[model samples]
Target: MDSHPLKTLLHHHLASDASAVQHVPYTLASLTPAALLPSPHSSKWSARITSLLHAKTSDARWAGLCLAQKSALLSQPVMIESAQSWIAVALPLLAVRSLFLPRLNLMYLRTKRKESPPVLRAAIRLLRVIFTTATEMPEFQRQVATPNVAKFTVALISLVETCLDEELKILLLSTLTRIIPIYPTLHRPHQPALTALCFVYLNGNACKPPNAKLTTAASQLYAVLHLTGGKVGAANLWRKAVDDALDFGWTALSSIRTTFLADGRLPQVQSASEPITSVPLNLDRLRCCIVILGDLFSAPVHRLVQVPLGALVKFALALLTCSKEEKVETHLDPTTRMMESLATPRIWALSCDLITALANRQVFLGEAGPVHLTTLQSFGSHLTPSAPRIATCIAFQLEQELTPSERLPFLDALEALFSRCYTTHATLVVNRLAKTVLPCASSVLSQQEETPVVELESNGRSKKGKRVRDFEGDEVFKIRQVVCPTTVDGQIVLRAFAVLQLLLRNGGLSPALQSIVCRVCLSALLALAQMTPASLSPDVRLHALLSATIQKTCVEFASASVDGLSKSLGLIVSTCLAAGTLQHEIEYLLHPRLPPLLRTMPGIEALSLFRTEESEEESHLIKSFGLASVAPSAPPVVRAGSEPVTLLPKRQPTAPAAQPLAPAVEPPAALIFRPTPPAPKPPLKAPSPALKVGPAPAEAPTLPVPMDVEGDETNEDMPSIDLDSDSDSE
Candidate 1:
């Protein structure tokens, strides 16, 4: 920490003399080329530099400038030090830099005006020289090791964090990127710094027209460390970074609005601090988000789960929304919203990846808890609005036919998206799936079926009978047409089937909802099933595998049902065959596909789908199809004090009232009212009304009364008696 005599002397003399400052460069220039870094004077020069490098000095505050200048001057352009001379100075300089370089920019930035700080600029150059002289050259490369790398990475990371000059940050990061790979094993000591550094660069901006050197540095450094021994640490760091970025994305994008400049460009409006940068910082942020996710996704399943995927899903949407092109009063199309960042095909691709990643990350796939609910709402907002475009991008990319490794992740993502998203989001996904399958479906639907027919005629060959008509038959064969889907199309459709199945199971659908979804899924399912390969091809094999996977999921991972899915598959064939693309299915096929469950009750039709009786439109779609009929309107409401109501059927006037056969036994039942029956003189000829299912109500009992088990009212009690002495005559 103490100042060296030479350093103190140089500082003091340079202020007063001014001649000493001029004398040094001249003195160095006047020296013999070998003496400057001359072979003859190499040993003595190396010795002096070694002493100067080791000397305690007041250089701590100005280390970046002093060391950078010294490093530049020592590694002269006119005469290179023999590889031998590098031995003494190279190790010490590297050692000193690691110790001193971490905060090179902070002090420099404070004193700097608009221009880049001299110290940091010199320092970046110094690092480049050290890296080239040491790691890049084969002769001195042995000096690169973990301890040195740790120091270098830490220093560079600190500079990157504090350096205001984007140029310097880029320089520092790029240098570290090269050095870190030389000794990837040593970065643990500098993990935190590396993580922060990666975050900055992965989301950093460009210098001119736009580039991603920092992003590349970030990517390289991460790859060297993480892909080797630091998988666990890397995954943790990535997860944390993703969560943080996702939070920032949510906050940043939720508030990010768009407006049109006078020139017709959609300018992004964010908080005052988030100044717009030409490098597309939003794109960088999205790139960072996707990189972390893309890497994590490639990690083991357990490691992948470490990510808070729900946030990633929201973050992806947030990225798109934030980057969306805002068309104002201009001739440009309003729908063309892919910005510089999003317009790059990768952004759209990443968006789908994150969506798919989110889908794959089902801790509780169908859980209806608070977290799931939030995820559902967020996913709906992000996906429903842009699913068509996202799908288009994905389809286009797939059309490029990337390598299996490259393409499978996308397919996995699509499968995950279809399996995981639900409700309206699920509807959007189903629509995408339908679009994916429609081409194949249309091709298959055009094929025709042939049936074999046979005719039997009486053959006149009299082998054994009188009128032996032998069977003369024209044999025909029946060709049951199969859907004939392509291998890729079949696999994609099969996956689509899984998605539909997941929607029903994951949504915890009610019978009505399940029925509605079944119908919707069934329409697409039928279209897809039409291409269902009868023979076992790759697509057919995948179908069988998918069926088993789904069955297994139902058995273990999820509470879904293979049988239910099979049933859905069957219904898809039947209903779709019956009502080709059920009216409501088309609702989901359009841009911004909305789930039928969102605005309407589960019903037979969507377009002609009628609201309940609450509406005054007086519509009846169910009745129109003759599937059901309308009932007569209800009678008007009766007042509380209105006349007594009766529910009894009207009596026939042609028949006289019947007398009870047990009239003699019933006369003693009510002695107090016996006088009413005394004057009856005519004999009753009519029979009683036929006994109904329940006991007939007594004629004398009031209609509103509650039935008592002990009422003891007999059939003979209230009978119309025969008054012509018919009982006595009998």
Candidate 2:
């Protein structure tokens, strides 16, 4: 009877070698101990399998060959091969169907997890192939409009997602976001996928669109709204989307506008077939329009300089009234309702950009007065309650006008806005207000100081008791905090210092010094310089800002005489020398401050004194002073045998003079050598005839006097001159 050798079959074919057959079969009934068996082939088999799996493929046949070799019971070869092919086909599908995945996943999980197609492995493999193909195939472009291609693409995405392990889900989502927009599909059913793509496509070009597929997608609006991170995000994204849409084509914009204008209504994302009372404006769309108008206002004045006044007015009005309702009341939190109300969404940033544009060519507004200025006047009032930062931004914008007095109401509104900002937290708004208001603060403070005194009643006669005078309004210098108030966060403090630095560098310091403002300014600088690392670690930027301000203060003080600046400079220098001051703190002092102060103080007397007292040892400091004027080269001595030729004495000491027999006779007063009295300074020559331009003289007899005009004559005692041809001989 023929019987299969199961052991041999298992060892030879499964173990990757014929050598496995040499092992004893069943150990010959186990009576004697079997000779030690050969090493197991498991390790070698594993290595061989790994190599095969990693082997490069020259063609599809390589995959086919790999499939042929893998044992059927041991592996799923077909599944592996299909995974390879799926990568190439799925990439574009994922790109196009990218929007639908999230929603479909939600639906499938809720109602059809078991029924959903088992395409995850196939999907992942296909995605790999597609990415590879994209890099390799130069001519493979996506065909977004074709239904066949779109459907296939969607199927591929669905497959890859189903097979992806949970650990890779986030990574897969990220990849799909980049890949999906490449196919650019607009299927209505694929809204969720498109939304997902938008979340991923932080700055995608498709974001600008009149494309029906994108417009029809239910989640598009939300995706756009949520695209940016928060309040600022909404403002930024809204601006970006409208700008992108405008760039895509004016016709697309016109279509959107025309649809809204028809029947004088805003178009709702919801279907026309659905019952409708009023199509409430989509906050997303409203925000987008606001951003577009904002862009118009904020862009360079020249860009809109030529825009017809009538058109500008019309667009402005349209933007102001675009919303379906008169105002936007978003309940952002349980306690606070943010009302995005506007005569238009006009605010400081908008005012600055727009008014600057109009004022660039004020004549246009002049011609279009009441109608034009009316809108601007309205805008200013509307923005009156805006943030201090916003108010400042707007004020700077209008400041370019030849006379801000023309816009007094607007200025008043700005004052009110800043006043409110100040009341919230004194320091909070000071730094912000300082940017614009500081420029004019001296005048403002002067006016304030005078007003309080005017309210005081003066008694001509002396009273028994002291009289009370109202200097109430003159106290702008006093920050409410006396003792160190709760310290501000580092960033805020840095910003405050930055603003102060700007004020000092720009034109404000002179005025500040001349007015009572100097005290507050000094206090601010001291606060900055004295700030400790424990309180607010000096970052490089904050340090630089403080250094610059200190230098400016030093420069201002430099203009004063030593006595005039003594107290102020002392305060400043001491403040800088306070505990946390670094070496950089003294750097500014040397450049312009200390040098000028030293010059003014009778030859560096003050700094010399300061240096002397501060040295590590008192005796050493005294020694330094005694040695200060000593030359680097040692003192000269007369050497023997060379006509009293001077030589620098060597550092070695001479034997102590033999103890003087009588108390050491004081050293004989050496012949004091004084520089020969400057050769009796040649008598000032009387004005020469040529220099005096005397009357022309009769020609004198011409004869050579043998004078040494070239300075060639030598005195009898002088060494004879040598005129060797070689320059070295001289």
Candidate 3:
């Protein structure tokens, strides 16, 4: 088989060959170490490779860079230790995952002195890439299995434990999550030691700050460990601790966390999705608690059902409500308020997360009928009375926080309430949400007014350095700061838009009301898009969605005036075009991909073939409605939109004449090609043959009896009745 292209590239870079591109194909494919396997001289190779680590010469540094790429792309069991030692020295250099200096650019690539960060990023990225390959690609898993890769796993586990930076910890945890599951016996996670640190990844930091990859990694890890190892090894110990803690019902982690949720049992997961097998290890404590609880539910035939569902929900509610670190509102100053405003909902969100996870677990477990729904019902039963309070909390949090990460759980809780008991609680939640967001909806998109600078007292002493001001106390400044849309802004907009969209779709609001709110949504979105540059993903997406929402609802609420709808549509479309992305409607119009019609018919006339009978009368109906006031088929002098002068048949007070029309003589039989007429159904009143067969041609009138040019002959012809009347009067 031909050598992989990335391998060729790495080899050429190691050889410091500029002409290597000519020798080897320079195509980019997925980078993997499988091709770089089988180092026969593995023992002696590290000594020779270590010289490249100093990277003194340009070619040597190039070789080091190549080696870093190789370490990421090409480590098998034979070279794992050597690669690790090399990685240790070069770990700090792994700063850039996507840097590519072409082999052709030897001078620039070689002469670069700063190499550590790049090497470090390359190393970390390699961990990610390899972990991904091992997890996804079975070939790598089967072919690359080694007896001693556990040593490397242990080192990585240690690194994850000690790593301070969330990014690095994430990288390490992600690597371990993949490694643990495939070779469960290699390490004690599924075998060696499924460390608490690993489980912690699924909590606050992983789930909320929303390091999605990390969270996913951690979740996968836990699930994999649970499924493969089946609560054996260190997994059993962790499970036991959770089982013991929950054996006696505890309301919320708060009641138990201080005493029972110790570091040994408790993980520090800031947020989760990451599992030991799937999620990155988070350092957050609360995240660990929830993740462990989740693991308990995940295990086969556990004690979760024994616990009251109300207890779980109430615990979640209390945790969600009280988790806000800030107590007593700080209305002190703009800076303080703003800082408080943007902070996330914290562990309270995590508590809600646990409830959601529990609910999901019940759903997936499905050992019995309707267990998940029952759990949700229990949750709603408790939430119904506190609906207003929960609704208020949700609304306030949405307003206060900039990041939607922490708000997600609260939103989940609200969704739970809605789904479980929409009648009593859904309206409360939705109304609060709409009321909170609607006021700011327009203002967030509004143009900023310049704030006048306040007069500062002259201190006379020259300031030594540039002073950065956090807040200047002007309404405009505060407004600008508040409205400066970011990912968080996009999230809120999406959420609010989602609520309105749902309401619009589910017939949540009346038609007239729906139209009005839809208009508001469109207007607000337009203002947002206008203020927002299309370069931002959220902004572009919001604009795209705004266009879509309008389209979906416009047809639904047909009572809306066409002129207003047109203006609204024009606003969104023009804004998108202005922003440089084509509007969706315009895209469809310009390239209508309708199914092909039968080609037997010619050109546009084929459309007439499928016309419905009602469609034929559409023009008449249009004319009747006064819409087609000035007919296009009318005289050229007539203007469009003019009131049509319709000639209606005169109405008769009496019923229609029932006299039968004189039957017409049949045409001569010689015209044999003519179509035969069919007998028709009886009519209510038979029309005259003149009406049925159309008026017969009138006979040529006899020329008026010759009238004298200027005499009584004319008078005699004028009418004997008038002359006789005169005679009789005389």
Candidate 4:
């Protein structure tokens, strides 16, 4: 067989030299496909690679790994052909399982030396490339990777456990992440060790100086393992993983709490016999716990797991309290500095995220199921005391220099906290929440207000005129303006209003605080009214919601007997009027619960006139305002030529004079009268001709009829007739 071109190069330059081995990968990468896969020499090249990988020296094995990585990167066909052989040869170099064994004898110790960093790195890189390349081809994976996946996974787990180099560990984690999904069942056996390793790195207990790249890789790998590594359903695995993370975090937190107490960071009740020893705070562990919790909370879980919200709330409150504690240290280590930098903001942000997640999941107040109710009870018990601290933390986070996107979570968290906690601790939550949120919301909204337009006059001389004069003789023009908030700012304002509404609706504010809230709401309403129609569609809804909120604020104030209720209501009415909104739009302001002073206001009266439907409440409102006369009434009847007819009262009847009693007569046996049969009617006479001749005579003068007087004796003397009498013959 012809000699291969790389044989001399590998044996001479790359066999014992590290620098030459570094260039081997580049040299191999630059070679053409024809050169890499020479038909007659392909078998010789494979044999050489296998021999080199199996060589005693680490340098030769390093060179072999480089060549394999390059071969795998070329194409699927080459990877399929060389993957099995490369894996077999490289697995021993990558595995650190033998390092844990005792030194049996001198010969065994000498033969079983751990691989050098370069060789192991090269091996990991080679495997990463192989998996990355093979992931694209089903044939390579099913044919080559299927048979060796179990051992391969075991080797990776060993390296992860025993590998000391952070870079190599990151590489190994990335490699595991890529292949865990493909052979999830194979990884099931090693899932526990893999999980522990991932947590080690994620919790930052592994290395002193925190490596962001390492932590990120471990986190991603951890997620992948739980999502795909288990034989159980993904949902079950996800829930269990979340629960495990929570438990792990709680343990770390307990340790942190103990340290805090020992160090006097937190107040503790100590006994006389107990010795006082200062323990250092494990900021690294705390940071790791926080990062893990943040990731778990931020990710979307498919199942509804009953999270221990009480514990989580306690954890968050502890962190917030710890963050505020003053730590006076003249000197700080790198790890401390790193933890301080990352953990502070992350602490606040994670608190916000946790609250937001709990709210979104509806763990506390979603349904009436047994699980939800239990969670609610536990959460309430924990939150009752810490509600103020939680609100303060949220407010403090909002005051930070956060982007609109970052501010959104804290805002949502604030709103959720207010909504859920306002029931038990309404006064405390409302006062704190309103003080912070209202100002922030107002400032953002005020920034978005349209800037005043500047008007300038041009003094250039007109073409037809000689003297310099004002252009168009002092005709000033103003530009029309619209108040359109950006997408993010608009959302912030909307949420702010929603929170304010919640606070106001809870009816727990002092009169002074209520006034401040009213002013804020009115200012927002004015701003919305000034918005142009061409503004975003969301603004329209915002305008409506703000109007209702203002009305609600007014009603709340009125019911609470707060001062300036009328002023608030009047301001709203005037704002509606100035905004050109129809009077009926704010008819809610005419609530019966409102003070009677609203009735005397012209705006209220005008709005009342526009009410198309008369509810009982409005009727009561009108009556309380003494506005019954102002209400619409029936029209009066009119006459054509004479004056309107006057209504006359009926006259009383006069009593008849007493007359002598009639004498009683003796009864006859047949006193009943019988009517005789009527005679036949006579034939009609022919007198019509004489009556017609006489009809030509002049008619007598018509006499005017006398009008009936109120007490007319002439009509009273007439006898009354009884129609029910049995005198038919007469």
Best by lDDT: 4
lDDT value, residue 63 of candidate 1: 35
How many residue pairs clash in model 1? 13
Candidate 2 has an lDDT of: 0.33
Task: List model 1 lDDT by residue over 184-298, tens digit each.
Answer: 5565556566766666556544343334555655655554444233545544554554466566554433322333342345444543433344225554555555555554444
**lDDT by residue for model 4 (36-94), tens:** 66455566656767777887778877887777777667654666777888877776665
Estimate every model's Cα lDDT from 0 to 1.
Answer: 0.41, 0.33, 0.42, 0.54
* Total clashing pairs for each candidate: 13, 17, 59, 0
Runs in model 3 lying further than 4 Å from the true structure: 1-13, 16-144, 159-168, 185-192, 197-224, 228-284, 287-312, 321-367, 370-433, 442-494, 507-516, 525-730
Point out the higher-scoring one by TM-score: 1 or 4: 4
Off by over 4 Å in 1: 1-240, 247-285, 294-313, 319-327, 330-349, 359-488, 506-730
- Candidates in descending TM-score order: 3, 4, 1, 2
Q: Which candidate is the best by TM-score?
A: 3
For residues 1-730, write the lDDT of model 2, one tens digit per residue. Answer: 6323333333444343222223223322221212111225333433433333333422222232232232212323222323333323333323323345474442222222221122233234334334323323333433222323345435444643454343334334433333333333334345455444442322222224332233222123332332223333433443444454334222222322322342344433333321121111222343333333433333222111223334433332333223222222432222111222221223222333333233232222334332222122222322223344444444444344423322332333344343222232323333334434333322111211111211111221113433334267756775332221222222333333333433333332233122212333453555456544333332434444544554454435333344535445566566555534535544544444444433311111222223223334433433332322221333322122322222223222322333333222222231122111212334222333222112222432111112111121231122222333387857
Winner of 1 and 2 under lDDT:
1
> Model 3 reaches what TM-score against the true structure?
0.44
- Mind giving the per-residue lDDT tens digits that candidate 3 earns over 205-244? 4234455556555654554454234333434443444554
lDDT of 1 at 61: 15
lDDT of 4 at 106: 16
Which residue pairs overlap in candidate 4's backbone?
none
Cα TM-score of candidate 4: 0.43
